[model samples]
Target chain A: AQTVTQSQPEMSVQEAETVTLSCTYDTSESDYYLFWYKQPPSRQMILVIRQEAYKQQNATENRFSVNFQKAAKSFSLKISDSQLGDAAMYFCAYTPGGSQGNLIFGKGTKLSVKP
Target chain B: NAGVTQTPKFRILKIGQSMTLQCTQDMNHNYMYWYRQDPGMGLKLIYYSVGAGITDKGEVPNGYNVSRSTTEDFPLRLELAAPSQTSVYFCASSYRGSNTGELFFGEGSRLTVL
Candidate 1:
């Protein structure tokens, strides 16, 4: 069994600024996958980025990127040049490599962007 | 493309009431899953199916039941509704092959048990 933790329950950032959301997980498995999903007011869960445990390099998707520290078991998301649309609930998820793809998610962090 | 569709968008139930939350996907995905989201809790898997006629319990399945009759549909049922069961339900699907593949989620169905 694995669990993800999002320490921050809420966050805010100014328009065109940068903000980072922290995430940590507990897993004994060697091979796994980590993901970040964003849920806006519309309640649609959108995948922001993903990182494979085998890869040492972090993942980046445009304005969204991740700082994955494998040994420390930390995967943080950084949103740059933040926009109002970026204000939403961001979740961190974890899943083992060989399972049925059941994702264990963190409580989530509500991000607010001020213009 | 009607990726994953779940309905009704919102529902209110009383104790002892029974209802099924419908889910359907047109992407021909082989894997479908049911997840419930509480206020501050992210999503907890209730049930998932690898393929038609094959389903398994997930993290939170005590008060929920699911059936995967067709590859396109996986419906979740709540029996003897309890206030503890009130939450937003989301239906998701993914393709076969990679276990690390991405999941496509529906807009979600909000249910309130009184």
Candidate 2:
């Protein structure tokens, strides 16, 4: 079984600054995928970014990027130029390569972007 | 396109009561999943189905049941609801082939067990 952990319960960043949310996971599977999801107060879960375990280069999307360290089993999310809209709950998820595999998620990190 | 749809955005049930959380996806996705979100807790998989008539348990399957009679509909049922079962439930689906395919989720259904 794979388990994802987000040690940071809460994180805050001033507007236009940068913030990084930490995440770690335990999995024996060599082939897997890591993802970052954001949930606003509206209660809608949105995909922030994703990283393939096999890919050595980190994945970046707009202001969201991931620092994926496969050897350390760590995948952290970084948000640059943070805005008020970035305030939300960020979740780290893992999915092993295969069919019918379910996503294992971390507790989540509440991000507050202060103006 | 009604990627994924869940009914009863909010509901309140008494202890021991039973109700179904309806979920439907029109994208013809082969994989559908049910997840519950609690305060401070991320989504926990309750059940999932690879296709019609094939459902399986997930991380937290206790006190939950699911059935996939058609490719478009996968419904979750809670029998004898308990206070601990109060949480927001989400339904998601993804295309076939790659396990890493992006998932499309429904708004969610908030259930409160009194």
Candidate 3:
């Protein structure tokens, strides 16, 4: 069994600024995957980014990046130039390697982008 | 494209009532899943199916049933609904061995048990 933890229940960031949402997971598997998902007011779950534990180089998507610290079991999402559109409930998830298993998610952190 | 579709966008069920939440996908995805999201909690997996005729229980499967007779359709059944079961349900699908295993979700079905 694995568990994902998102300590921040809510976060506020000003437009054009940067914000980092922290996430931690307890996994005994050496190889796994980490993901960040966004659910806006519309309630649509959107994938933000993914990181593979084996890869030391963090994964990035445009202005979205992850600081994956494998040893410390931390994977935080960094959104550069935050916009109002980024306001949403963000979830951190974990899945094991080579398995089509269900994702284990944290409680979630609601992000608020200040105009 | 209708990636994932769920029926009964909103429903109010009385105690002990039963209903099935319909879900279907046109993307030909091999993996389908059912999840429930509470007021302030992360989505909890109810059930998952790998392909036609192959279904498995997930984190929280009590009080819910599901069937995958075909690859495209996966329906979740709530037997004897209770207030504890009131929540928003989501249907999601993804291609087997997806590059990043990203799930495409449906609009969601909000069920209220009173």
Best model number under DockQ: 1
The pairs that clash in candidate 2 are none
DockQ score of each predicted structure, in the order shown: 0.65, 0.62, 0.56
Q: B40-76 in candidate 1: lDDT tens per residue?
A: 8999999999999999998899988999999999999
Query: Residue-wise lDDT of candidate 1 within A1-115, one digit each (tens)?
Result: 5889999999999999999999999999999999999999999898899999999998999999999999999999999999999999999999889888478999999999999
What residue pairs are clashing in model 3? none
Clashes of each: 0, 0, 0
Tens digits of lDDT, candidate 3, A3-109: 99999999999999999999999999998889999999888799999898899999999999999999999999999999999999999988888767478889999
Q: True interface contacts reproduced by each model, as a fraction? A: 0.57, 0.56, 0.37
Off by over 4 Å in 2: none
* Candidate 2 per-residue lDDT over residues A1-115, each given as its tens digit: 6799999999999999999999999999999889999989988888889898889999999999989999999999999999999999999988888746488889999999999
Query: What tier of docking accuracy does candidate 1 attain?
Result: medium
Candidate 2 lDDT score at position A68 = 92
Q: What is candidate 3's TM-score for chain B alone?
A: 0.96
Output the lDDT of residue A40, model 3.
95
Candidate 1 residue-wise lDDT at A70: 96
